[model samples]
Target chain A: MTDTLTCANLSKSYGGVVAVRDVGFTIAPGEAYGLLGPNGAGKTTTISMLVGLLKPDTGTVVVGGADLSADPMAAKAKIGYVPQEIALYPDLTGRENLRFFCRLFGLPRKAVRARVEEVLDLVGLADRADAKLDTYSGGMKRRINIGAALLHRPELLILDEPTVGVDPQSRKSILDGLERLVADGMALLYTSHYMEEVERVCDRIAIVDHGSIVAEGTRHELVALVGGADRIELTLDGDVDTALAKLRGLGGVTEAVRTAAGSVRLIAEGGRYLLPSVISTVDGIAAVTAVEVVEPDLEATFLHLTGNTLRD
Target chain B: MRPHPVLALVAANLRRHSRDRVGLFFIVVMPFVSIIFVGMALGGGAAAARLPVGVVAQESDPVAAAVLAELRAHPDLEIKTVGGEEELRAGVRGGALAAGVVIPPGSTRFELVMTQSSGSGMAARSAVDASVGRVAGVIEATRAATSAGASPAHAAELVRRAQAASADVEVVGSDTASATPRGFAYTAPANLLLFTFINSMAVAAALVESRRIGMLPRAFTAPVRRGAVLFGEALSRFLVAAAQAVLIMVVSSLLFGVSWGEPFGVAAVVGVFALVATGAAILMGSLVRSSAQPSAIGPPLGIVLGMLGGCLWPAEAAGPTLDTIGHLFPHAWGMDALLTLSRPGTGLGDVLLEVAVLGLMAAVLLSLSLVLFSRRTRTL
Candidate 1:
């Protein structure tokens, strides 16, 4: 089967600044792909170019066998995009907003009513579909926003940070709904800075930074990049910078950096055995208040590759 | 089987407008209310009362005195004496007097001076002319009697007896037809043009709001082309302007007894002017950076343009320079077309030039606005 989306060498720049540089990816049908990056890491710019909102300085995109530059309408028709912002109309009820998108997408008039109903049920907003969007919670509005994208039943769905600013319960509902969509044979390209979400929903994940994809693989394959290294997080009581410096010089500690939360995180081989020496190395500079020797994961993989935590 | 995206957009805009009570009040209710108030302020739609007329007699000529007395005796005329002809002319020109009559020295005929552009001035002229014409007839009959060798005293007695006999016999005549409609009829069309344009321009805020909320970008993500989106926005504005025009026309006609002349002529004017308004609205939406900017500026700008275009008063009455300047706005052409239709025996053929000019204005404005709006939408 043909890939649902195939983009290669995507790059964009604004004036003198480069936003995305030589980025490329492809997603098979029914597969979930995640582009993980922190804020201002060029995820949105890449998405914008992919959706044809902006012309890439140099690149190409193909959706369901249609070249985006040659046949935008056909390419766009095969893709569904849910932007990070809640883009639904506030004055309109949920049903009205969905019906409007259906008309815009040129769905058959006879099928619009049934399709709108189905999408509302899929998003789990059928009971409150008649309520205007202004009356909905942030999470509910985000669900409606997602529902709008699904009305046309595009072959691939692209969501940019879908769970940002949403309540936990509603976020869970959105994730559950998305999981069902992926299971039912819809390709997904999800972008977010949240590590757990990407790990939970994406079949394969790509760690993006500085407008380029630095690493790409499945969960186990990505963790293997860390090479049997364990992640050790240390909470220091005093002089975190000095402790970070000393920890970086330790024999077993390959990587050590101060986190945004005033803690030192280090990656080392056999971190469980190195814990005693790790505490002794920082003993004079700062007292070790807490320590956790975590096994290799995507976060450790991101840190291992980018030399910076995903939260950075 | 699906509706075109342009029509879908138009439908959605109209639905949003319908839900906004404040917007409905401005677009639907305010025009008629303004018509009633402005019509009443201009002394229209009320019972006819006594009109003030100034009289100037250069000499104490008995014939002139008799004419003045006859004018005063007429129930519809309230006569005021002026010291000289200049003062009488000034009074009529200044609108203190509806009309003025000057009886020159050693002349039997009287001069009637009034501003022809004023409806009341024209009415006063008719009343004064009737009184003067009656006196002139008596004078002519007396002179003929003298020419036949009758004594002056006998001629005077004969004229007095003739006047006494005619005093008890009253002849009522229907009022003369005018090209312009008075009272609510005049205000209805004027306010219709004013409010429709203003309301259309104000709806630019909606476009800006859509952009701010990311709705425009979301729409662009659909399978539709940029041209379809721009056309959809323009079509929605046109529909709104057309709806406002129709509502004002229907309500004014039914409630206030306003007779809009020649159906096809009125439609041509309203339809073209609606397009012009849509163009202006689209241009404003494209140029403004924020929703508040259009809301703050649109109404005041519309009012100024309306005033210049004769929505507040007759442009002709404002003199030649202003009348020439008024045509620069589409509202003036619309007003000219509507007023032409109000005249008896006039049809679409008679106001073709005005309609053509308005159509041209609409074309230029729509073309320019569509180009700007297309460029702006791409950035959004």
Candidate 2:
């Protein structure tokens, strides 16, 4: 599938300060791609450039096979961007705001009412269609903001921290709406520091930092690159020293962690070999309750690659 | 990816503006109230209503009392005590008294002073001349009878006959049909000048808001040319100004019976005036980053310009230096053109120079705004 949006060597600077530097990435059609980065890691800057809101000092952006600067109208037609801030007029009603954007896009009169109702319903805001935006709750406003971008039925949706500053219910609704859009064959470029959200939605991700992509892969592919290790967590009653010694001495084991109590754990490249060894290492342990080895999640893989939590 | 539907957006913006309470209050209530107040203040017809003229006679002589009392008896003329000539002039200036009559220390003839404080000083001059003329006519009649040796009954008959005839005020060899000019004839046109300017300048908010909301960016993202957005915004403001000018004209002409100089000539002058206001507002608004600054600064700035332009008062009342300085503002030229058109028997030929100059001013302002807005956008 062709990439709906592409940026090569994208770089931006504000006077002496560098905001985005040498970043390159592409969002393929019908695929949900995440741009995961820390708060000040240039996520917003990249989105701004890709959307043609900010001019990049050095880079090329092509949206829907059209060069943004060279052929802007074609690019804008395919993209729907939900801004990071509440941008609609506060005094205007939700329906009124939607109609304005619809008109701005030059939508047909027959399609306008239907599209407005459709998007509002999709965002779970059909009931609040007539309410003033200023009177809406944070969640309701967020839904309406997203709904506005959906007015023109863009093929590619660019959501910039869509869940930021939103309540859990609203965030879920937004996430669900995004997923529904993608399922309907719309391509999405979703950016956020929330790794779980990225992992839940995106088929592929580019972990960005300092205006560049540090890692790019599927969730499992990234973990393998970091030398996949099983996270073996256990609870025990006694013999903490012996357990730590035995697990550490094992050939395949990478590290043996002992709790302040007698509980002990092991992390290794191979989970099968270390499981029995760990069980035997902790002798005389009371009520050895649980033993489970799971694949490294995107959170662990992200932390392993970036050496920082996604929340940061 | 798309072309911006500028006209539709502008229409939506206009719709929202119509409902805005703040905008409504300024566009509607301000003019309505000021017209009533200012119209009665400068008036014969029912606007700025008329200033109350007070008369005080230090002379308790029967002749002097009759003159003062005769003025008090005139219809629609409100009379109060006239303290002194200076005080009466001061009252007129302060808008308390339209005019005042002070009888000289011994002579029966009173000193008359009219205030040039209002849009037209006709109300003040007439109010004063009528009051003082009555007393003077009575004294003159008494003197004539005494010198001719007429009897008391004959003198009474002569004075009575003289009192029966009222003297009329002739301004520039023409008698005003009414005591003062009619409604927007007195106010609406001035307000038209004021509102067009204020509305155009305040439109800076729409520009600022677009920037803040990222609408500018999205608009640029469209294959839409940068010129389109610039043109769209300027066009929107100009359209608003035109609408305001038309609204004021219609209301003034239809409701207030205000006769604009010549219909076609007035329309041409107002059109250019609207253009000037539109360009000025866009240039100023683009210079500022925040929408709040434009709305805040544009009105007061427009008011100051309007004051100079003759919206608040006639520039003829200003000193020569002040008049020259006031012409630096487009409102001054616009108002001048309007005045020429409004005066009796005047037509397109009379206001031709004003129209040409104002049209040139609008062209310059529009070009300047285009240059400024483009330069700022490029730098951004």
Task: Give the top-scoring candidate (lDDT).
Answer: 1
lDDT of 1 by residue, B1-380 (tens): 97677777878888888887888999978897899977764435523456788888844778777888889998867889899888988988777777888888778867888886665676677677788888888988899888888899999888888889989887787566443445676778889899989999888888877777778778888899878988898888999999999999899888887778889988998999999999999889878989888778989988888877778876656677887888899888888888778766778998899989999999999999888876675532
B247-276: candidate 2 lDDT, tens digit per residue: 777776676777787788888988888888
- Weakest 10 consecutive residues of candidate 2 chain B by summed lDDT: B174-183
Location of the lowest summed lDDT over 10 successive residues in candidate 1 chain A = A303-312
Clashing pairs in 1: none
Q: Model 1, DockQ value?
A: 0.45
Best by TM-score: 1
Number of backbone collisions per candidate: 0, 27
Q: What is the lDDT of residue B155 in candidate 1?
A: 91
lDDT, candidate 2, at B25 = 73
**Which stretch of 10 consecutive residues in model 1 chain B shows the poorest summed lDDT?**
B40-49
- Residue A90's C-alpha lDDT in candidate 1? 87
